[model samples]
Target: MQSSGTSSQLDNPPSYPCEKLLVKPWGWKWRSSYWFVTFVVWLGVATDLLVYSMVIPVVPFQLEELGYKHPASLTGWLLFAYSGGLAIATIPVAVWSEKYDARKLPLVAGVVILIGSQIMFMEAPAYWLMCLARTLQGVGSTMVWVVGLALLCDETPPEFVGRQLGIAISGVSLGTLVGPPVGGGLYTRFGFRGPFIFGIIIAFLDLAFRFLIIEGKSASKLRSNTTEKPNNEIALEANTNSLTDIGNDVDVQNKKVSFVHILRLLFRSQRALATAFLTFVYGIIYSTQEPVISNHLNSVWGLNSSKIGLVLLAGATTIFASPLSSWLADLQGTSVVIIIALVLSVPWYVVMIIDGHLALFITAYGCAYFFASGVLSPLTVELASVARSVDGIGYAHVYGAFNLAYGIGTTVGPVVGGQMYDHIYKGWLAICLLAVGLLGLCVIVAFFYVGEEPIVQSFTRRIRLL
Candidate 1:
């Protein structure tokens, strides 16, 4: 019985099982390097949140001042253009990184952003130049979104991958919490250049960190070049094959897969993409809420920057709950946790739509987002695992799709919400209703497709509301 119990534990491992759990191990240990990579990648996430949150609130007003009425269309296009860059670059970046290294991409992107910001400073009067600058930032955004995530997957073991991802995602949440208040304050005080200046400083810092702290060989194939190998082993291998034979073998191995091959692989399996579609829908709603919610408070409630920042800060504080969400993902599973999170959001949206007082509104909406982002992390982890299973190179493409969904939401939300505010309900309720309805759709999708497991059983058995 004791031997059987030990065998069972070995077969179905605990989520946090580590070096101490196992008696025999087959691989070299590198905990310090893993943590270092995690820190650097987390910083990259910080850069993304800081830069994006900086511009979103102010972009519409900036465009409106340029005598561009009906600004929503232009805003939509600008966001789409940024996401478009991410989409177009995703597959190509993956392919390139297969033959090269991804470590330098973030540093390169930071340099571009710095130069772009400086140019924006020089050409502040031109609207098109501002668009160009944003596009350049988008290029860097794509790199951080893809490469940083891939590194997380490479660094952690399978059981702990979800938790590690949760930690990394928390950085983005921290940035979200910090960026808006800082940007809004700077905008209130320093005018248009405030956010851009902040981003430029962050870009420089990110570049320096990437160059100085992160070693290339730790995360790249460059290590393979330095490790010593037996000469006789190499000679026996070379002697076993003719030059032409070796060339043919290499050619066959390196043969590029067709786009259809990739599509088929993803659709044929149950991996990230299946779960990612749900996330794509959730992202649309979540992205729309950010700028629109703040805009609503400012336009309707007459809130100042400090008050608005406080409102946003309330929502941002939900980040503190991410580790708890991650724990839930481990104890249950991502699929079950996602369903619960989305279900909780539906009521939050309903509350946001109806609540007139600032305190009540922030409390309700913040609670929703707090739970919503919790769901978001597990969903991303499952999606990344999906891509990793399908093809080692498809991770960025998956993220590109995810980003594209967010871009769509951010792009459309302002325009749609603005139009609703002006024409339909003449209140923020329309946008809130839309968010509620979309979240409802997500719940329906989850019920039908999120699947069953130890995860589903645990959720149903432990947290069953039905």
Candidate 2:
């Protein structure tokens, strides 16, 4: 009986499959390393964003070649189709990630879809086929982002969550920065096929990296095998630590939460709803600017695809500040950082409305982008905190909701912004003022309703006691 029990334990280790890998001289042992997982996730996110954004500047030109008379409306619909797919897929993917043992599979599936979408983009002769391609890309993006982030939170120490998320966001920024220039430059020189070819290469790299990732649970099991303690005892201890660590934020009863249950819990928390709202608003700001700015550059300055991409490089530069913004959130709290960033955005909007020179336009847009990055960098951390505070174990679900908000905004922003520009070509100044007013209101809501204590508040309390 003793021998049989020992054999059973060896065959079926108590740790999750993510824990450890067998240590060979080389081979798959690298899966057990934390840096490997982090790098893979970072690259995955960057590549996903890169492929998506690379098509943006080239969309107008592509539509013209495809024989579409009204490219503006078509462009908005195409953008909307992608975000609609993202929003629709977010919840289902989140639930799957939460329930499944193999988190890497979703990532692999996503990359496969991405590759397919790129192929469609390159070869599709019809408009509907192109829209289908963009929608598939969006679905793939949802899978990668939801699963990748949940895996990152699971593997990382709680204290490092903010910093790590910041790094991930920086990767996204880097992709956005590079995509337009590369896509536009390539398309200008080599036509539509050039950008899609480059995207396929990056997608393959993303796949290989995801396949090699080993989760923390698997790594822990491998380490347990080398320890002096009995295998069963090590398993028990590891399980206990994991439960204790997660218990603070997640009720034991709610461990196996359903998708509907996650929605209910999210709405019940004021902070979660507030964060979701802000994410929605941020999405609007991001998606709205893309078509508007691209169109503006083409119409006003008669800039070609290559030159438009150069102008966009200004906005991309602000993404470099993501680490700093995330560190500030860790130190000062997300609410404080969000409020300050929104306040700063007001003046930038005013500058944009003035519409002076090309240099001025780029400067205003860059400053606006910098503030937007500040909001995005820490937004996920704040959402995670809210989930924990509400006794929720569904990190994937929380982020799924955040993405849903963003996806909705992306879906709506381009359509509305595009229509507004079409009807009122000279009405951008009025639109800027309206956006500023809305941002101001968000700041007020964040200050009053978003419940986290800022670093300044903690200092004040300590001073009062002294």
Candidate 3:
């Protein structure tokens, strides 16, 4: 509930070890519930991504063993199934979380994931059945990601929201970064079902933790109760404030609208709508490229699983750059940084298009990922700012929309690229399509989606942290 004159309060950073975190200047506050929930959610997402990473490398070997002649085509279908499930399930899960308490959603989703992973381990039928199991995993992932994030927001205070979100999302990036090598290593030695078995075990462990991790609601609500009401009661007793003081309290409550109303409003909002568009374009380019990248290295470069794992690690370089990217966004605004990053990504795509040079390939890929990584967090932050007055779950829906779009792109990208490479370019076209799609998306994002407007322009430039 920022003041009308200082809505810049919304953009301030939380107090943390970093000097840049100024939003909560009253020193960093800690609550045990927040830390526990963040850890559980991060672990849940990280494990899921790690399991997914194992599949890209494991799939080709497994399919070959299962008598599939065309591994690439089968791989495409499996990826499509997984991403499609995620896209379809995200909104429904969000709606479910809104209707019920988030506490149960994680527990249920985790159980479903455990069941799906176990099925994947036991019933490694043909390619199609594998896809079905992955699809179920996707559904469970959507539930966990959306519901968990919504719950995180519900439990966090507004002042420290960005920092908390930064820490939580880093877990996702960390999972994606680490999953491939670990999964690939296990698959290299133990076989395809090994990772699935591992994933199932981890999913079960996560399920057990869900019930143990206390919900975030009590902390946020309790803080508000202990701090807020006393202020109101004091003002009422003193009678020192004018009618405007009492009216301000009512205004805050009035702005707190229903979840559906917020969704409808966001859909209608130009800024929010543009953010969604950026998300869609970003998803198509980014997700479409991910599956095939490792395959490309394996098939084109004649690299072993361990070497390909190292190449995948190169993409994770962006992880180190994310906090700096967020800081740049905080300094210069997300819109500017996003547009610049998109423009810079064009040449990186060119490098990917010419994959003969290994150095060039890794360099271009790293740059492309760096820009994407940099823009990712800030984009969500900006969109959240747009819908700040809405329910905490509203932010999750916005994020869910982006994930759904990304899932669609990811589903289509790999299959199409894989088939194209298998049939047409003799393995060259896969990278080509990824590059072209990415560059084209940069154009759209720069010119059509995120115009030359800073998100914090109309708000305060600076504010007292906390």
Candidate 4:
């Protein structure tokens, strides 16, 4: 007969292979895993935005340094090149990330690309080299953004998505807040090389954070004896009952959807299409502000790069409002929050039109940024909801399409805004009017097409019952 110890060993099998069960790192614990991943993703996004914005305040000086006769037009083209690269890379990266079942690799590769682009920017010998650098930067940005966001969605619970996304947006705002001033200050003291050195340092830091990220699947495999379920299988199982409860007819649980089919389904939902359009317009409004505000400070106010950077700081302050807005979206419904934000934005734009003073301009733009921040998180939450309602496999593609729409807006905004600024009378007024019209369209679309029950109706019903 076998000894008691031997029999006990055979009876209680190991939960995981000996080699795989070595030790759990700090991030691998189930309790802290999601938060750690979210923080890393947030850092990656902040670093991308930091690097992108760092170049903005100094663009004019760089053009002049390179002896360009028309820096204004080239600036627009430079912005276009970046957005074009992003538009080209986003969908491909999204598809790649989905197929691989790991976002960590792509995240690292993107940061590596970012580091190389910054080095090129620092050492660029010709205008073409700078353009090439910007394009590479855009590609890196697209990879990070698309993969990072998909990863976040994959890890996060559906109920908390809006708040989590809001937190991510705040991280972005922090980067935007810090980058311009730091870049401009560095340029003022040490010229182009300084900001790029700073960028390289941050890129490495971001890479380190990405390397430490452990996907939930990998963690589960380490912690359990049985082979873990595929992430898609888990996601489908989790969503099936909710989809059925909502009266969804898509049958996404077992379906393998093509990208084109995903697109078709999205378009068929008027709500989804409207969300996409609003996202596009939101991109236009924000991207248009960067070039226009920088140019306005330079040409109209004769401000130095450092002062312009300080002025831009006003916009970043609005980031603090993101969590509050996200909470409001969760409580009041995303549609109601969006409609209220749009209505509030009109007055801010009107104020901008009426005031040319530095203080007034800063205040108006800050308020505009505050309202704009409210739109992004809610809209993203809505888009994700719509995509899941259509096809469980379509979440990654939905985000890809959102990025594509935003990329197109980024390309169009600078080019059109620059041309209008150069050639049209009261060009600022024209841009503001366009913004108003776009906001009106979004409000109408949200009112009629988006399927959320009206917050007002819900409140009224509760009151009637009482």
Clashes of each: 2, 10, 2, 1
Q: Estimate each model's TM-score.
A: 0.77, 0.87, 0.76, 0.86
- Identify the runs in model 4 with alpha carbons over 4 angstroms from their true place: 1-17, 30-32, 225-255, 454-466
Expressed as tens digits, the lDDT of each residue in 1-466 for candidate 3 is: 4485355533442333222221232212343367666677667766667766666666765777778777767777777777887888887676655555455555466557746755674476665677788787777778666777666666667654555555566655676777667667777888765667776777777777676654554343233333323333543433544465578667655645566775787777666677676666665666555555666787768876667766777668676555565566666666777777767767666677775878878887788777666666666666556647444436566667666666776777767766776777555555555656665665555444452354343233344332
Predicted structure with the largest lDDT when compared to the true one = 2
If ranked by TM-score, best first, what sequence of candidates would result?
2, 4, 1, 3
Q: Runs in model 1 with CA error above 4 Å?
A: 1-32, 60-80, 99-103, 114-122, 213-256, 391-394, 408-411, 451-466
Candidate 4 lDDT at 63 equals 86
Model with the higher lDDT, candidate 2 or 4: 2
lDDT of 2: 0.79
All models, RMSD in angstroms: 11.5, 5.2, 11.5, 6.6
TM-score of 3: 0.76
Better of 1 and 4 by TM-score: 4
Model 4, 143-178: lDDT tens per residue? 666787777777788888778876776777878888
Model 3 lowest lDDT segment of ten: 19-28
TM-score of 1: 0.77
lDDT scores in order: 0.63, 0.79, 0.64, 0.76
Error of 2 at 277 (Å): 0.3
State the weakest 10-residue window (summed lDDT) of model 1: 17-26
Candidate maximizing TM-score: 2
Q: Can you tell me which runs of candidate 2 are displaced by over 4 Å?
A: 1-30, 227-254, 454-466
